[model samples]
Target chain A: MKKTELLFLKEDVDIPYNWAAGRYGSLFLTRLRDEGKFIGNRCPSCGKVYLPPRVVCGPCFTPPEEIVELGDTGTLVSYSVVNYPFIDPETGSRRPIPYTLGYIRLDGCDTYLSHFVDETDPAKLTPGLRVKAVFRPREERTGRLQDVLHFKIVD
Target chain B: MATKVAVVGIGMTENKSRWDLSLPGLYRLAYQRALEDCGLKSEDIDAVAFGHSPEYFEGVNHPEKWCGEAVGALNKPLFRVHTGGTVGGSVAIAAYYLVASGKFEVVLAISGNKLNETSSAQIGLSTVYDPIMGRQFAAGAPSAVAVQASKYYSQYGYNEDHGLMVAVKNRNNALKNPYAQLRIPDYTLEGARNTPMLCHPLRLADMCPTSDAACAMIFAAEHRVEAITDNPAWVLSAVAVNEGINYVDRDWSKPIGLRKAAELAYERAGIKDPRRELDVVEVYDAFSVQELIWYEGLKLCDWGEGGRLMESGATRMEGDIPVNPSGGTLCANSIGASAMFRKAEAALQVMGRAGEHQIPGVRRALGHGWGGGIQFHTIMIFGKDKP
Candidate 1:
């Protein structure tokens, strides 16, 4: 038997992190850091409201007919505490792990929006937990999903 | 009697880490080749059926919109179908329906994947599993296949040598394929055995290459087939079958979707014994173990006999039933395009157009694709003479 040297090389490559922009199904989430205003898209065909509006209604296959104002209060449908740091597109760096990401079913919307949760305790999180949207400060507000700081446990 | 649909022309772009061309540029190259092969212009195409895997693979959503003009689908009836890796073959199946219905005289089926455009296709594929059940266990495609391989070996008492032999044979065959991406000059079973393991029971060489390429095929009704080419590869049967996504319920060691899809295709193609009736086979082998599993799923061999089939050299190019004469997805996998390439390669073999990898006297060829956690499966049967 002969021995062969086997080595794996990791290449550093510059890649486009924002290639999803300008696409037809591009999702737009308004930064709601300071205010509690809720936004959603309404499908004219089915009259169903979709939170974190989709370009086309999954059932109807039609573009959203109108924009609807949703309630900031919603029920937490599902959640997970990410134990590993994930690459952040905005920073091009790894974000701290153990952060709470949850699906919030806003009032009047048929679907849920995936966002960060403020409460870090995994034990405290449960399905159907009432939460309210917390917005970023007005000065730091940007027109992105991150503008909605996180979802906080509503007292 | 329903009119038969046959493949009139086929074309494919070079498979590699394509950085020289953009997404649309890739489609134009294959589309042009297909049109020229059929001796027709874009205007002659009645409709377009396109398939690409996850939109995330290209970092573009609604890729059909971007690829419309390049594939000559601009302002034409264009439909996009995605079933993960099987999407390419599914697209051809969709095109066949259009021609078989006697509504469309000619349909152009195109598929492509730009793995280079995505920062990490592995990450994209990893996200496809259930967020909770499989995501944590996901070590990407290699690890999943390795898990299946481990189970198969444990159950069947097969050794790692079988996989090494497959890698060596496929890579060797790739030398004859001009479109193959990973061409090794002195590839051998010994070289494969020494390669580092990406996951247990699965070495790096056992996995398919992440190439960026496009493949297109023109489908026409029986009335229009003779006008396009004298040697049309008639489509005998096409079938797509889906199974539950949960890997826990099904046997990962064996693919049920593939078996079901193959059974349905065999029934429609009037095939009694695939080993005797089918002359060539192009299966979806993203991993070496998958080809072995597919050998049984396709019924080329009995259950628990896939390893023996390989050991007996029954699947070689000169074997009783030639499998993967095109080097399969192992040599070049442009995910979306690979499935279409299987169908195209099988058709080419039947048409006697496959220059180097052609199996002598190939009359009936089977093409298959599987994707989405192995939940989606597509099978197509092509023959030199009309069914």
Candidate 2:
């Protein structure tokens, strides 16, 4: 067999992304990391609670004045079992396949928190099913949605 | 007051993954056809309005500089607009304004996205959300749409079967549209349901396939509309609006921005009853669920009744208000070009040139697009007779 000589060059470029959590996000993450609790801002004008708290309400265009502490328990507004796998940018690895994700409307809050659902069986995951967030170990807490390992059925 | 504007010519590339062609080639493919259709040369165009989503896919900050030459806008005036998914529709509206202002007699509006060049559109879409808030849960468009689908399904008592009909209908419709990316001749409800589930209530078939395509349309002032072609799609009204991204306060199922934009367009067009007056529609159905949601938001039906409306076969090709006669975004999603494709399809319907997908005696058509975090919306109305 004869081999054909070929020349190839490879170049690698790294573009780093740094984002500020801002006032609402900074406080929300700080509380989650320190107290292991979820906090939301309530719009006084329309009386709507925002998860991961927004500085201002979208509809009324009013700045929320009250930051409300919310319970870890909530109802699953919707959920889906991931039958496909894709790259997870966080760890630069593929997200585990067949995992379940859920959107939970926390108690006393109007907005739904989208996060990983502990249950993988689609039948068990139903809208309106009560679930509670399970926090990761204190040492492993990351002050992010991952701070809570996943949401499990309250029952 | 704005001067009257009309779409006198349109050109669209086949909606499929064009890995062989560069971004500029794709733009030229459509621009050349549009120029030929209007029997005009490159120099005849006074200005060019380009549209597309974020520049992440092209791996460039300013894409127009790379693609504008294809449309012959080397030194002449050029405008670019990017409002997420609605970039295409926004471009068309901008071109309409350029002509309506009487600044330019002939303006070419073009937009497209070469999704095949990107790694994965999902990854690109995932990075668009808030880094701290919804990033973790946002598994791109399908996941976001799944959330909307779940909310609508629960609130309106609709199920996957209702959405399946839309999938089957659009896929079947694609069979008639030669440029569509997805053309399934044997498409069925059961077949659609059999597709792998990407998210809860959303299957692979329920989502639009990312394709490489460009759509170009020529907008002319009233005098030029008469001089260019007698069968022009008169632009009755074009309106764009945006709501806040906070899904907490707004209903995800029925987008307020879409409804408000439709109202503005209808009011300006003197359309009392859209369901009764409009002959056809081309809505941004990136997902099947959005198609149903838009039916309600467009006031084609009452709120929470879109599911029933879809089941009624009212929006089918042979139905009263045939929507997506060109297979819609669900069949071929070129992201930036998707909205412009809708506008082009609506214009084709008004011109009575939509080949096999043509609805008989169609007079008026509506084109819609939704973008941003489901916030920005654009609605354009087209009529056969000059408005």
Q: Which prediction has the highest DockQ against the true structure?
A: 2
Q: Candidate 1 clashing pairs?
A: A33-A135, A33-A136
Candidate 2, what DockQ?
0.42
Off by over 4 Å in 1: A1-155
RMSD of 1: 11.1
Residues B207-311 of candidate 2 have per-residue lDDT tens digits of 899899999999988887777888899999999998767567456787877888888999999999999999999999999989999998899999998888888
Clashing pairs in 2: none
Best by TM-score: 2
Cα TM-score per model: 0.73, 0.94
**TM accuracy, model 1:** 0.73
List, residue by residue over B1-387, the lDDT tens digit for candidate 1: 667999998989999976667788899999999999989999999999998888767777898888899999977899898888988999999999999998899999999989877666776776675442234334446545655676576567786787777887788888888999988999988889888655546677888988999999999999888878999999999999886543222356677778888899999999999999999999988887778889999999887889899989989888998888888899999999999999999999999889898888989999998887677889999998888
lDDT of 2 by residue, A1-155 (tens): 77655442334334778889988988998899889999999899999899978878877789987999999999888777766677665555678877777878889998878888888886676678999999998888877878999999986
